[model samples]
Target: MSGFITALFDPTMPFVRNAALAGFLSSILFGILGSVVTVKRIAGLAGAISHAVLGGIGMALFLSVRGIVPGLPPIVGALIFAVIAAALIGVVSLKAKQREDTVINAIWAIGMSLGVLFIAKTPGYADPMSYMFGNILLVGGRELVLLAILDLVAIALVLAFYPQIEASAFDEEFATTRGVPVQAVFLAILTVTAVAVVLLQTFVGIVMVIAMLTLPAGTAGYVARNLAGMMVGATVLSWLFSFAGLALSWELDLPTGALVVTIAGAAFLGVAAVRGLKALAKRAGRRAEGRVAGQEAGR
Candidate 1:
């Protein structure tokens, strides 16, 4: 038993330990970002940006095949392309007055199609699945460092721009009237969303990134009375879900992304149920009070 415990917690088990830490960090980052995404009704944008990563992944693969970039990782390419795609979508949506969802769908389709074509043209590209559906086992020391840096950047940005983001999210016109830079705030949100989506895609796949971004935040929103509480609750919920999913996947031989998403979904449903029950109880209590008051008056 002692040997087993030592082996499990050993520093030499960097693979498992680092991967777990990365997952936890990713969950917290995404959860915080997800709050803004949900409040702004941009949860679907995460999906769009995630799918758009295919273009970056494909570009990276093409570069590697030609040896134009020897050490340029696919994720780097994905981040660049995803950011561009997200910016383009934001610009187009803002300029044309089109609904955000319409712009998002257009970006998603084009980016994914482009990525697929690029990958098809590339030779010996066998691991597109990792980008489509995350492989936690593939995370390494570099990824851990990257996650740490990104987390710092994300947290700093949120802290620095909290007021603008909060006002814009609640009311864009009101924020603009107050002399806030609405366009800049909107763009910043998109940029962060793109980066967050890319980071999460490494662990949850592009398809599941939305779940990671929105589920925990949505659950937190259900129970929180204020935006600050919502963000804190969301981060905690995300971490819990990630840890639970990791353990369950290991024990059940399930796909890690799927397990993580399942845990998030369960949390969402549980929170919704609790909220519903509370509302029902509140209504019942009010009705009972009214009935008792009527009886006393009649007597």
Candidate 2:
């Protein structure tokens, strides 16, 4: 921990600061978009898109090496793929002609498979592990800038469309009857989330990114009474998890992304378990009171 802090100012290790900044900026996205995702119950859709991005990453790497789309950044491919996947899933879900899960699973399977295959066929061995589980040290200044930009955009969009977003989130059908353009709003939400997924994939990798997205908001659900409140609380928690994960992982010589997700997962499960216990105890107390009342009435 101390070494990591020292390195943050060492000037020789700029990546440390970038990693820290990545957590700070990205917590905003995780909080805002993640809250909507939780309320909308679209984590599965989010998950599919996150995983599906690997296909784009793989394709970009393969193409770049072959001089077809030469020097293409993997993130560009990821963004393209994620947005397309989100649109496809959104359209199918909106139409309701077929089961949405089937499409989601199909994308998830195909995207991941394509990524693996592309990486395998690349000029040299391309390790899928980094994209699968990110390295905090590899996070660059450009990515940090991108995360900051995404944070601003997400906040601005949420602020501008809070009413419609809230209405659509809690009850899409009701929002539609109220002339909210529910379908458009839904598609917009998915699209923005897709973009965030592309950036966040750099933070926690594709597989674990979804965990951070859902966990912070899931924990916030215990306290937040509204979507806005959930966003605020979850953002704080996400930052906390991200920062702590960086510090501890640095100190322990562990994987940063995995450590971050583990922290989030632990916190979320702990909150949930405590809430469950309290609810169970309340129910038990009510049952006991009910029995006593029944005995008193009979007597």
Candidate 3:
């Protein structure tokens, strides 16, 4: 405990500070965007976006190695791929109606395969595990800045169009009748979500990003009275899970991203179990009350 506290406060340890900042920023994005995703029932779409980011990362790494785009960062490639994937998915979801999953899954698989092909063709060793599982400790100052910028963008867009998002998410017919520009707003949300997913992939990697995005928000859904409340609750829960995961990773010498996801998964399961038990107890109580009422009527 003492060592952990010292590491957090130690000015010499920039990585620790970076991790803390990354966690906080990521939680903000996850909390807000995730609430919208959950409310809109777009978790599968979010999963597809997260997985597709791998293609961008692979393409970036390949370009960097081949000197084709020496200045292009992996995140840039990831950002581009994510946005494109999100846009395509958004369009398909809007128009394809019956074949949305078919298109999304195809994109998801092709993106991952494209990534693998690029990585395989690149010279020297490219650690696929790092991108697949994530290494939050590897997050640096530049990535921190990028995350901050994304947070601003997400917050601004969400705030500016909260009414439209709420209307469209809950009732598309009503929203359209009210002239809410449902398609535009929905596409905007997807774009924002894609960006958020790419940034978060830095922390939890491609495979685990969906869990990180959905679990906390899903947990928050149980207690929050509204979308705003859900975002707030999810943010708080995300912070708790992230901090605890980081601490545990430090103490136990574990993978930071995996630990973070595990912590979230555990919390989600716990909440689900508690809710289940409560529901079961309530049902039992109702049955008992019914039995008593019948006995009294017989008397």
* Per-candidate local distance difference test: 0.80, 0.90, 0.86
Candidate 2, backbone clash total = 0
lDDT score for candidate 3 against the true structure: 0.86
lDDT of 2 by residue, 1-299 (tens): 78989988889888888888888888999999999999999999999999999999999999999888889999899988998899889888988737899999999999999999999889977898889997767888888888888888998999899999999988888898999998888888898899899988965698667998899999999989889999999999999999999999889989989899999999999999999999999999999999999999999
TM-score for each candidate, following the candidate numbering: 0.87, 0.97, 0.95
True-structure Cα RMSD, model 2: 1.2
Which stretches in model 2 have alpha-carbon errors above 4 Å? none
Q: In model 3, how many backbone clashes occur?
A: 0
**Candidate 1: lDDT over CA atoms?**
0.80
Per-residue lDDT of 185-271 in model 3, one digit per residue for the tens?
A: 888888878877888896668765787679999999988999999988998888888888888888888888888888999998999
TM-score of 2: 0.97
lDDT (C-alpha) at residue 210 in model 3: 85
Best by TM-score: 2
The candidate that wins on lDDT is: 2
In candidate 3, how many Å is residue 94 off?
Answer: 0.9
Candidate ordering by lDDT (highest first): 2, 3, 1
List the candidate 1 regions with Cα displacement exceeding 4 Å.
Answer: 1-8, 66-72, 125-127, 280-299
